[model samples]
Target: MSYQLQDLLYLMQRLRSPEGGCPWDRAQNFASIVPHTLEEVYEVVDAIEREDWGHLKGELGDLFFQVIFYAQLAQEEGRFDFHDILDALVVKLLRRHPHVFPNAELYQSLEAAPPVSMEEVGQLWEAIKHTERAEEAPHQPTRHLADIPTSLPGLTRARKLQKRAAQVGFDWPDPSGVLDKIEEEIQELRAAIASGRQAEIQDEMGDLLFAQVNLCRHLKVDPEQALRSTNRKFERRFDFIEQQVQSAGGDWTRFSLQALDAWWRAAKEQEKKHE
Candidate 1:
């Protein structure tokens, strides 16, 4: 709490330095430490969902270290440092939020605002990307849906790609159409199964998941977070069932399909009632 942001970043970088520092930290690089970044994001989500402010504070600190770690590595390579990164973000934030800080009179309210459609807004974001790229390289926004990091988890990346494509009117209009597409994809997946071709089945499975991601967009839901919540829900309920069975001197391996189904249904009902 006493340290400023820069001071904390400095401390973290020092901790990762070669001389008299953490071995695990010093061994890490951008690509090698990706799972830590992903795990920290999930920890932040967990803390927020549980409303644990103390845990959130700790998780946020860990996440901050991840960023600073990357900056430190870049600093060593003379690519950029934390200060440069900070200055770039500050400039971009001020540019995007002209309505709040600057005297620049942006479109008056939502209604009085300059009638820039979503299509135009996407173009504006692209413009900003172009400006950033120019600063880094003389790069242009060659494609409408370009530059999304491939390293992103498939589900999240799929949603972002779908949203980007929708900006160019490449998306279905309604949830009904999305649902129908999902059914079509499911049929294709079943056919792939019947065909018994491994490569075709993999491709069909990817298509099915991609269709589901688009359906999530049409329904105005976050596919990745929805899937993660389902995972946690099952984890909690199954753990509860396991505990109860042990308390009653029952072995988990001895559970029949019907018995487990009954427990699972009870868990679902309990979850609904608690909510």
Candidate 2:
């Protein structure tokens, strides 16, 4: 396993070599590789979602290559190398998993203790993370809402931001409260529409969406994943509508709203029949 990984690292180094490396590979900069890295990550997730082990192996290799690409770029700039990255990761893992490490302060008790619930493990993990954060930057100001990446998808970021706030007790007491907030936001959105102010409508729309994220958080659902699942369902249903329209000798653009509605209902009925 170590030999194979070392060979892959050597291959990456050769590809980035200025003398006779692949032109396109050598041309890539950190910024230029971001899109490919993101796409590869999504491909890996897609493989796991589909439970395609063979495809997953390939996708994971692609994802790993993204890490290698970044590490190579950093090495060229005299920042760090692949081993440095691995060292940091290993150090972090050992630091975080005190219960599993022999030299850990609580190792004896953790090893001798009876089985614990996953919730207990999670609380311990969070506590360790808090300690690590404080130790890593002792001079930095303590921040409850530590900087979450703005590059995250809006729904996912909102969930994370809300979760951070919830850690400090700034959240709805229950999912029922979140549902009520959603209803309130809906009314505000309707009023915005009635007022016919574009800015108000946009602001209200944002509020409604934010409320929806809060409800998802309270219900322990990932809003981004939920949205993606709905997107796939819509695609499937729309494809069924298109197939039906074509079977009936019609273009979708030429179909009436009533006709489309009928097709949509039929598609839904087909789904129920399958279920």
Among these predictions, the greatest lDDT belongs to 2
Q: After superposition, how far is residue 213 of candidate 2 from its true place, in Å?
A: 1.3
Mind giving the per-residue lDDT tens digits that candidate 2 earns over 155-254?
9889988988887789999999999988999999999999999999999999999999999988889897788778878999999988888898867678
Model 1 stretches with alpha carbons more than 4 Å out: 16-19, 101-127, 130-141
> Which numbered prediction scores highest in TM-score against the true structure?
2
The sequence of per-residue lDDT tens digits that candidate 1 reaches over residues 70-110 is 89988888999998999878777667554343443344344
Candidate 1 at 236: error in angstroms? 2.2
Model 1's alpha-carbon lDDT is 0.82
How high is the lDDT of residue 47 in model 1?
Answer: 94
TM-score of 2: 0.91
**Cα deviation in Å at residue 126, candidate 2?**
2.0
